[model samples]
Target: MKDIQTHDRQRLAEKLRFLEPDVIEVITTNFCQQHPETKEPGEVDTTHCITDARYHLTFLRTAIEFGTEETFRQYLRWTTKVLQTRNIPHHVLQRFLEEIFHALEPHLTDSEKLVVRTHFLDVPESGLTERQTPARSESPLALHQEVFLQALLAGDRHAARTIALEALSSTHSLSDVYVEVFQESLYKIGSLWESNRISVAQEHVATAITQYVMANLYTCVTPSQPSKGKGIITGVEGELHQIGSHMVADMLEMQGWDIRFLGVNIPHQAILQLIKEFQPTLVGISATMVLKVPIVRDLIKDIRNHFPSAATPRILVGGSAFRALPDVYRDIGADAFAYDLRTLTTLLS
Candidate 1:
């Protein structure tokens, strides 16, 4: 990577001053035209688009001029604050960075392009390190792993349910079994697939078995008599992994929130509609893949724009994606993050 100190910010500033107006206009026009259907009367319309464009232009100029890791870090902090408070989508950051590249590409040389791409854009989804299964000290569940694995691989939902129900009957609360047993089982199965110890079909079968067992356990959850608040939970668009988010929804339900759990792969517009209809106090979004973090950001941003400031729900995000990138959920503009179900319960409580 090129060192930031060696570059002349003045030169980039001069270029940016010249280009900023046109860049903003181009971006605003294109963004508005592309997402006209998102516009609501007296809400996120032309003025909001213009404001977003201006913000994007200012950030890009600052980044190119400063060109430092610290600058990007600070920007992320400020941007995340806006995301949490103002309803800016995470993808808007990505989109703005991309637009800057398009605007500057014609006038800038290759070296300058590299700096912009490296410093402000091109963040690896799961961050810098190679991904690994989180290290754990011991199994939290009481069930025999060998038997659970056999039942899952054999596609015996009844056996899986029995094991889970047995745990519930003995020492495990629903939450404990979920995190200790089901989550652990999924993790082990995932590891097996990673190491070629299990077939994709077997891994899928395990997931299905767990899902069935989860449903069996659901009827037993007893929330406090009065509801705490309302919540709507979902996965981002194109994300099919519903288990983690569903676990959260169930936990929240047990905690006395009126839960409207919309599972995996919900469209953006549909989420907004639900937010309008459900009128939740909290919105829990989950994404399993790094790429979908942008979608979470966008979802939050859209929620901010679509709802009145007071009415917009507090956003909570979790899942493997956040676990892999420790600081990313904040960057995505979530009000808070739940690293695990225990943490989630505490945050909600």
Candidate 2:
């Protein structure tokens, strides 16, 4: 898997994304035609097939680009549970995956074909049946997280803000509020959506509420000490998840690092220009989706190319993208990878 060339992975990912709509149409249409019973009244809706196909293709693209076949397999296992929750037959999923492989087989190189076959196509149905449940933490802030999550789920931004502020006023520090309450609650909301227990709208609302609360809490954040150095943090291009980066920015600001957060989907040239203008001591990049890992690599490469080796800022990376593959930062030429604020502080020290 590591032997797969970078350009080949990038090319395959781009090709898969480009052919997404056509491939989905071919697979879904053929499945409906061959399994007409799926479209019968009260049976599996064709819309579900289209939705699943889109997610399937996306997972495939990310897995290919990141050279993490386990990512795709994990997605399959999770989707199996989600489909079961929705009353969709397991065989329908199996058949759809087969059709997808056949649809793309003609376009793949012999080695790529073998990869798809060996990693994706050969998984036993029995192996995919394992169900996973979200774990409960018995930490001091778990109760606060539960209440905060409920408030967000109810779209009560005001209540959520109160909860967060109250937690901050207690024994919890600012970092505790951010990590234990805000971050943990958001993680639960995401898991609920993934397990098909919550609608997309609900997830969005919960996220928006959390963002609102975070902003409200920011007013209370004061630097514990004088400024140490300047830092610029941003989510990589095409990475829409910004809250993690936002949290990093705030935490660093509170720790007395002068921070300029550029938000999400920032272009590489724009980032390079900013680095030149700001001349920060640290450049922090966040990528949430595995699909954006290649973009992060390319961005880091471009940064290295644009600046002289001695003049380059220490580039640090974090976010959920690297959670399953922590050493990916080393592979991508990053100076360091920090999993959270604690590790970030250690790295800077």
How does each model score on TM-score? 0.64, 0.87
Best-fitting candidate, scored by lDDT = 2
Q: For candidate 1, what is the lDDT?
A: 0.73
After best superposition, candidate 1 residue 303: deviation in angstroms? 0.3
lDDT of 2 by residue, 22-72 (tens): 888898768856775445356656875677688888888878776787777
Candidate 1 per-residue C-alpha lDDT over 128-182 given as tens digits, one digit per residue, 9 for 90 to 100: 2233548757665634555676788788999888878888887668888888878
List per-prediction Cα lDDT, in the order shown: 0.73, 0.84
* Runs off by more than 4 Å, candidate 1: 1-135, 140-146
Model 1 CA lDDT for position 219 = 82
